[model samples]
Target: MTSRPAAPVPATAPAVPAAGRLAAGEQPVLPLSGELELRPWRLDDADAGALLAAGQDPDISHWNLFTVGSRAEARDRIARMHRRRTAGTGAVWAVAPRGGAAIGLAALNDVDPADGSAEVAYWVLPAARGGGIAVLAARRLGRWALDELGLRRLTLRHSTANPASCRVAEKAGYTYEGSLRDALAHADGRHDVHLHTLVAG
Candidate 1:
């Protein structure tokens, strides 16, 4: 698959806060658009209930951590994300449409500052499927990671059965690195997971 050049980082916005984590309750470090306006997750969004609700949609939550357990567990996880953000661990962004409710979430799940590498994860509402939103979101997040965070590499993983997800990663410029058999065991059984990676030029 062909890769699009990473978007140029804007000079106006500071990459990350001095402490490492993006500043809480401020505008996105790199404003993004298309399909939806991807922005940083706000602690205030917990009250909106979409984060937890995303877990309830089977099509959206299948193979996702939020749906691994139960609805209450998903709610707790969202709360935990907020706490972690304040603790300077990482960020979970809400994929919200302008003047609409949040339909999904994308996050910088892991980060290694010394190596400048991070893993990106995201999900979309069942209602929002088939819109090319996931690919657009992933690309926007990649731009932020490369230009804003100055990351050297970013990776995304999905189950082999999830062809839509694979397409999203490919469209966003991630190379299909390979698959890991029995990588994740669902409640039913283990399944293979496809791993993809993108390195900054």
Candidate 2:
């Protein structure tokens, strides 16, 4: 038998989602209560003083996973967040209360539209922690993700040492899904993590 040439392959094609289904695109700024707004981050938001202070506060330091060193670095983070939002993989919202500075932050990440899932995280200034704002922000974001973004599940992960986050999850209606033993890498060593989840109805 004679040998035959193979057919040429096509160039890399764009990702094709299943018919009638598609990845969630960029999420727009979502609003919550009259006082609290979940809004897109502005460069000026970083200059509000609270953003840099939260990065330095022990209670909220976990956000500085790589240790942002200066106000400029923090401002750079806001810029990065802007890009992330446009990319549709995440969002960083300034938790601004009416007539006040942006005193906290909330966000969604690891957005997987194929899996209909995403991860939620947040922080409040030490001075902003007691008003149940974290819980409210988490709930607002979670609802919007499940209802508007078409996500089926949302997860919340935190170190076991951070009991405050656990309370926030509970108040936000996330069920405790047990711990991932020593799964979190920390500056001091490995730490056990609590995993929580909220499934859409």
Candidate 3:
């Protein structure tokens, strides 16, 4: 008697590799419109000055929860930024004119290369505000993160009270997903956050 045919084995879904998408390397200077660029933070006084200024600016301090009381602290923060890149956990860039001191910052925080996702964040100095620098920098960084780095999703979250950031997120082509209740804590108190996202095409 012929033996009964064996049942077919069910195919299993392919597993995602545990390797990280980002590896330690020389971070490239990403170009923005006409002389503006995003470069890695340097351990120089000028870059530290930018961080100090941001920490001191009332709006930036309030929104970003950043406070650098001294130049040394700012330098230490810059060093940490580099270390984050090396660790594949974050990528921070100084937004500036070619060969000039940074006037703003753009960052990919909480980067999970295995998951292909990261959060986008930025802040422009008072002098740089009102010129659409934040929008430009955000757009350029999003492109780099999605197109160049192969991240599947980029999230941008801001306190619900920050209309300017909402505008920036919109202009940068991020789609608003919804609000997150008590998602972020600020100097004032806990705040609800608006979540926006950009996905790779």
Clashing pairs in 1: none
- Across 23-48, the per-residue lDDT of candidate 3 in tens digits comes to 44689899999899999889884444
Q: Which candidate, 1 or 3, would have the higher lDDT against the true structure? A: 3
- Candidate 2, residues 1-201: lDDT per residue as tens digits? 987888889986433323223224544667777668888777777667766787678656653354555779778988898777666677788888765688788888887766777899888888877989999899999998887667788999888987888899999999998999988776667789999999888
Q: What would you estimate as the lDDT of candidate 1? A: 0.72
TM-score of 3: 0.89
TM-score of each: 0.77, 0.82, 0.89
Off-target runs (Cα >4 Å) in candidate 3 are: 1-21, 45-48
At residue 6, give the lDDT of candidate 2.
89
Model 3: which ten-residue window has the lowest total lDDT?
13-22
Best candidate according to TM-score: 3
The whole-model C-alpha lDDT of candidate 2 against the native structure comes to 0.78
Candidates ranked by TM-score:
3, 2, 1
lDDT of each: 0.72, 0.78, 0.88
Q: How many clashes in each candidate? A: 0, 0, 0
- Kindly report which residue stretches of model 2 are placed more than 4 angstroms away from their true locations once superposed: 1-27, 62-66
Model 1 scores a TM of 0.77
Q: Write the per-residue lDDT of candidate 1 for residues 108-196, one digit (tens) a residue.
A: 76666656777898888777778887887898888887877677789898888878889999998999989999887554467899999
What's the alpha carbon RMSD for model 3?
3.9
